[model samples]
Target chain A: MVENHPSQASKFKCEVKNLNFYYGSVRVLKDINLSVFSHQVTALIGPSGCGKTTLLRCFNRMHDLYPGNRYTGEIELDKINILAPWIDPIEVRMRIGMVFQKPNPFPKSIYENVAYGLRVRGQSQRSAIDETVEQALRNAALWDEVKDRLYDLAFNLSGGQQQRLCIARALATNPEMILFDEPTSALDPIATASIEELITQLKEKVTILIVTHSMQQAARISDRTAFMYLGEIIEFDRTQTIFSDPTHRKTQDYVNGRFG
Target chain B: MTIDNLHQLHRLIARNRFWEKIFIVFGILSLLVGIITLLALLIDMTIDGLPRLSWQFFTSFPSRKYEEAGILSAWVGTCLVILVTAIAAIPIGIASGIYLEEYAKKNWLGDIIEINVTNLAGIPSIIYGLLALGLFVEQLKLGRSILTAGLTLSLLVLPIVIVTTREAIRAIPNSIREAACALGASKWQTIWDHILPYSIGSILTGIIIGLARAVGETAPLITIGALTFIAFLPDSPFKSEFPYISFNWLQAEFTVMPIQMFNWVSRPDPEFQSNAAAAGVVLVFMTLAMNAIAIFIRYRLRRRIKW
Candidate 1:
């Protein structure tokens, strides 16, 4: 394990060390190192194109969708090297679920959308699938709104409900960590508040690494905040210290809105 | 000076709007011209063939007597040929399309395949007929039978099926694929469970349109030596005995509607000309029916999946 500072605990759900990433010939992330504490919300606050999304995608190897994207160094989840050559990307994804910025539910029924991950994990029993689907929807705070219309097409739901359904889909697999990529940026103020509440509740069950553009959101929900600029983390500290009195000049300027 | 400049800009905008209106008129004229030609042809076919459109004209087999001749054998042959073409082309075309769109990497091999498929789609149907004649008829020794004609038609339409299937698969958003992948679904499972279901309507539309084109094609079937005059039916697929379905039907000689119409149109008799026009009408109706079914299904699917 990497050495932790005396003030921080040593219990990390996942750890990244000397991580470097490139898309074709252009380096996007350079020599990144960070640790996600267990069952806590760690928010990555950065400007656009600062490699926050790239880092989240790297956690599940979502960059494998296309060719010419490369990664180096190590990302260990619970002491197991997730980036090891022998590890299957599909298996890694099951352990680390992701909710995208835009809510994308399949064009299937609401019940099918929640049950999809379970079905993919090879759960075939109808009774078990039904029970798990209900549990996931309840956890996502969507069961009461959608229980009567479980068979309706997912697109029939409102924007917030659809986002919640996407969360339910991600929750169905019961991953160790769930990554949220600007999950509330597309939502309205009310919807954003509800989703923020959901995130805080969710942190009790799974480690969350949320990338947000909103500094207020970071202050409100994140236990720890990492301020990133260019392609590097400028400061990693408690949310209170990062907001009230940062250690770095860059973090202080960013917190005071001097510049991105 | 500022007012003069604003006046000049207004004049330029007015001139552009005038030209746009002229182009719109030209486009409407061009569309009307095409639609008018089609309408004229349909009217002529109705006039020539409506009298011959009776129960007997559909039920009776072809004969030396023009009055006694019907499209039973030819229509049945067309249906059989289409069945074979669909069976041979649908799976192969959809699979190749999926591979090219979803699985294949952006490398030299993939580029070569894409370019070759585009080139294949441009080649004439008669060229495909010659290739099938050389390969299936002579080299494979399938002879000029029903199987040979069906296989030839399948080759003629394969490029269309593949091209349209690829287009349909490409229309699917990448988000759906990524969502499936993130849920721990394997590549094959993601494609089978999500991709195929979402795009099945378009794929079937492509297949039907391709089959419709194959049904109307004459040169390929004629070039492959399908008979124009056949009195007896092919062996029956069903029987009263055990193992009831028979494969012997495939080996029998067959005649399609186009070839039969071509034979009649080439004859000197006026009655034969009427018979040819009637057969043309039947072919047109069949093509229309297939297209209608495809359109209906595509419309329903579009409604069902709004996203």
Candidate 2:
């Protein structure tokens, strides 16, 4: 049994209740229940193939893109079940943004990359797009580096800059929540630290759900952490508690680097 | 470790190196065979036809006098037919390719369609000429005009364009598609915004190469009954009247470079054989120009995009 935090004051931004996910009839995530607090960073940490990424993807209905992927139960955002069949996945995606594992910037200019989401949403005013693009790039901590070359191809940027460009792309849409899937795994230590710092700062504006292979990353940035093993959450608690005083043996062993 | 072991290893390495040298020589020889043959033919054609290539030769029409006969009618017909072919083939071929690659579900029916499309490229070009004869010429009652010839060649190269377009689209990374979709773009939006822009360069390269093949095609045009001798050009695609553009050129009788060359070569006069050689050189140059354009576009686009 997982105990509630002593202070239950934070409002729930999203709540996953009895959520199950499957890939072509093979269950990958089993009965995941968790709460994501508003304006807080929640990190999902587990060994590879433990369904952490799958669970993260379910929040925005990313699984809907592929055939034969199924989801059951509820992923309620602000008390509304987004997993309902009638709810268009496009609507769900519009409200939530995602940064992929590697920097997958479009083969376009940096400004266009940041402006793409806005363009998709039909924000056609030139001034509004420029302002939002500037603000988003600033929020991603990339404005100073790339402002002079806004029209330069995104591929011209370094790996870290490209990742930030992708983040800016997601941010330009003004999504309520952002999901990062191992956003810094492809970067060096310096780039990774910058991105980690950016995520910590971003929580004041948008709810963040990130999946990371590194427990240290979750420990440093996440307000709350969920340690998953073999398709189930072994423990979910405040980041400190999960790292220092985990309730489950598997969580304790996994967090301590004894075994995965 | 041991001197004897070292000697054996050296001998083995030497033997392998000898085989590598032999293979390199063989590869170069194989490459030279095709290059030398082409060069020899080009040189022979130049020798036979260089004196015949004059401004008047390009500007004048075919005549009984060998020296007076030019390729004005043939080249104009070729250009008009190619224009029609490009107009007919590019859109239909590209749209079909996009539909198959992006919209079609990966099922048994899709598999069958895919196999048939691949097989279409291998079918004889003459078969396409026959189909065009039945469909465009006889059934539609269109004569052996530029439109009929163009449509015939279009049918012959449509498979090439479709196959190449699919290959180009398939080359795009899945991540690019996901990024577009993740940003709330609908399927059509994703395709229009990302897929088409990225793949346009390769699709064009494919289209031009297909057209180059179409340019050199003699069998299909002949099979569809293109004229062997013509003294007049097709109607100008532009007009001085209202609307300014004309479709009359499409319905005008035509003859292309290859057909002209074939007609000259079959004539009893040796001077006409020289005319055939000159026409052959110009035809080869036209094909080369199209390929060069394709290569240039591919290079430009490749430099702009990576991964």
Candidate that would win on lDDT: 2
Candidate 1 interface RMSD after superposing interface residues = 0.6
Candidate 1 residues lying further than 4 Å off, grouped into runs, are A1-10, B1-29
Pairs with backbone N, CA or C atoms under 3 Å apart (clashes), candidate 2 = none
The worst-scoring run of ten residues by lDDT in candidate 1 chain B lies at B153-162
- Which candidate number would show the highest DockQ if scored against the true structure? 2
Model 2's CAPRI class is high
RMSD of each: 3.2, 2.7
lDDT of 1 by residue, B1-307 (tens): 6999999999999999999999999999999999999999988977888888899998988888989988889998998888888888888889888888888888999999999988887788899889988998999999888888888888777788888888987888888988999899988988999989999899889889989999999888887889999888889989879998898878888999999899888888888788888999999999999999999989988788866
For the record, the alpha-carbon RMSD of candidate 2 to the native fold, in angstroms, is 2.7
- Alpha-carbon TM-score of each model against the true structure: 0.95, 0.95
Provide the clashing-pair count of each candidate structure.
0, 0
After superposition, candidate 2 runs with Cα above 4 Å error: A1-10, B1-25
Candidate 1 lDDT for residue B272: 79
